[model samples]
Target: MMNIKVAPPYAEDKVLEIIDAFGHSGKTYWKKRNTIKVFEVGNDKWNVKSFQVPHLINRFAYKYVRKSKARRSFEHAEILLGKGILTPKPIGYVEYSQPIGLTNSFYISQNLSYDFDFGDVIDKEFPDRENILNQFTEFTYQLHENDIHHFDHSKGNTLMNKKSSGQYDFYLIDLNRMKFEEMTYEKRIDNFNRLSLTADMIEIVGKKYASLIGQDEAKVIDDIKKSCEKFKEFARRKGRWKKRIGL
Candidate 1:
């Protein structure tokens, strides 16, 4: 069986046709575990992400107990937009299922034209680096104040574009893993742990965030530093395990 959902202003029939032709046509934008492709219908471009099939246990859970990633991504995008957060416009999601479990799924959205992502800021010598980092801290503060916790709040997930008014606009991507509720102080601080920021960059963000929330800047920076250290250790351990298993 197959399930499909399409948002308004985009005809269901056309979207379905695009989905059906997903693997055969379209330009491959990114490919790894999951694949993202760009498809054009008339003048508009649609970014379609084809989620990797789950393992046996997850397949059953997705079919019977939990929502598929595609569905979650679509729903989360809507919620973010409603809360005045900038994300790509969600188009829809599609899922294919068998008697035992869900087999494949896809999430669709409008392709955003952006200059760079947060990763680029760290890796390259970009103009207005400090200003962009400060603005990003404010953007993240807004997310926390709105009670939105993005689980995968890592580099590359945030796309940045410079506006004509001499300011920057930030857009969030990878909406599948998110939590919407009141955020605790620990959770809020831990959110920055996944970002690959240097010590100086961390200080900039922590100071800005502390000022926004009326917290002690030194304590905030210390806590963020601790969290980043812990995450780094965890990543190192995980990498060692993967290497041990010859993965």
Candidate 2:
């Protein structure tokens, strides 16, 4: 069976037709763990991300227990929009499943063209690196204030567009892995661990976030550095385990 959910303003029939044609002629964005494609409908562009097929256990879980990734992405985008958080406009999602479990799923959202992502800023020296970093720090602080916890808060998930020299607007992607709840100081600082590749970047963000939150910059820097180390160790171990299991 197939299940679909669409935005109120959009016609489900047209959206489904576009999604159907997506299999034939959409522009391929990237293909790794998942296949992402971009489709044009009139003057607007939409992104449709087709998730990797789940393993046996996951298939059953997604079918019966937990929500499918595509569904979660659609719901999370709606939540972000309601909270005034910046994210892509969720167009819809579709899930295809068999009697025993889910086989495939697709998440649709408006395609956002941006100037750069946080990853680019980290790897390359931008025109106004420090100022942009400071503004980005403010943006993260705003997320925390609103109780938005993004699990994969890594550099690649954040898209940055500069409205002016000192002004920037940030939009988040990969919305399925998120939590909405009150956060402690430690949890907030730890959120920065996945964001920066260099210790210098972490320190810069920590100092700026600390200044905004009325915390000591030294302590914030130390805590974030430690968190970064812990996260790295955990990821390394996970990678090794995956290799050992031939996954």
Candidate 3:
């Protein structure tokens, strides 16, 4: 069985044809556990992400209990756009079902032409480093204020494009693992844990975030440091277990 949801101005039949021809057509943009490809339809470009098929338990769960990751990514993109957040324009999602459960799925969106991502900010020394960091901190603050918590808020997930006015516009990607609800102080601070920032970089972010929310800069910086430490320890334990199991 097959299911598809698509936005307007793009015919359903055409989108289905693209999905059917996905294997041999399009340019491979990224490939790993999941694959992303760029396809040209008429004059516009689209990015399609094909999710890996789930494991035994999750296949059942996705079929009977919960939505597939592709669906979540598409829907969450709409929600972000509705809330005035920047994400690529979602085109659609397609899912295929097997006798036992879901086989695989794909999420499609407009291709975003970005200059850089947060990873560049962390690793490079640029003339506008401080300015970019301040703008990024403000963007994250807006996300929190809007009660959006991005679980995978890491360095590579946010794309930044420099505007003609010398400021930057930030766009969030990887939309599936997100929570939309009221945010507490602790939850907000913990949200920064996934960012691979150094001590000095975190200090800059913490200070800027504190200024936005009227919190004490020193206390906020200390809490963010503690949160980062806890995340590091958790990662270490997970790594050890994976190594023991030879994963």
Candidate 4:
């Protein structure tokens, strides 16, 4: 596995502590994790989100040497941007080492103009569902083709920018658990199986997505199932990326 590290900007900034410590009841901490705190600063010149660090989902023994979960999340965010994937661009981050510095870091990115998780639309009754399924099928195929596991693939973690016309533009969020290195068959199955539990419901979601993207269903169902497992084979992952890149 490649030694993952947070890119520049974050690596350079001296992590700032829970801020607005100087402003009006300006100090607000997150209730969920209770680790992060936020505040509006300088007439909202920019918003800051701060919090304690978290651990990697699978790798904890390397607590000291390996990158923290925060770093992985930020790294995937940055990597997706580099790959020209549709997502928010980072502004900067706050990194610190406990005791001496803030070990857990804070990543700040440009707030996407308009975005919502897929979960928001589900169970809301979209007239055309087949299209959504097609879009989702094609998109998931694309992701697997690229050998990206997106370990935390979920409604909340997956986001979208809604057009003023009420159309969706997808984006993935909360991406620390991504599996990007040397994908294996079992690993890929693990990824989809986790999703298969919701496959039927997701299929309905995909149908709507396909309609939204203006695709056909004549061959979509078969295609989706194949694409679902195709990437599991190393040959598929490599060949797909190669074919797409014209290699």
Question: What would the TM-score be for candidate 1 when compared with the true structure?
Answer: 0.98
Range of the 10 consecutive residues with the lowest summed lDDT in candidate 3: 122-131
Candidate 4's C-alpha runs over 4 A off are 1-30, 34-63, 99-103, 127-129, 163-167, 182-189, 192-247
Per-residue lDDT of 76 in model 3: 95
Model 4 reaches what TM-score against the true structure? 0.58
TM-scores of the candidates in the order shown: 0.98, 0.95, 0.97, 0.58
**Candidate 1 ranges with C-alpha deviation above 4 Å:** none
Identify the runs in model 2 with alpha carbons over 4 angstroms from their true place.
none
- Indicate the residue-level lDDT of 105 in model 2: 93
Worst 10 residues of 4 by lDDT: 13-22
Residue-by-residue lDDT tens digits, candidate 4, 1-247: 2122334544332223223241343334344552333444333322334444444432332345566555566777777777656666554554445432333455554444454455654544644344544455456555655677787665555565546543556677666578776555444334443333234644564454345445564344334455455534665688889999998
> Which residue pairs collide, candidate 1?
none
Q: Write the per-residue lDDT of candidate 1 for residues 21-135, one digit (tens) a residue.
A: 9989999999999999999978999999999999988889888999999999999999999999999999999999998899999999999999999998885477888889999
Local distance difference test, per candidate? 0.93, 0.89, 0.92, 0.50
- Highest lDDT: give the candidate number: 1
lDDT of 2 by residue, 164-240 (tens): 55798899999888899997898798888897558778778889988999999999888888999998899899999
Candidate 1: worst 10 consecutive residues by lDDT?
120-129
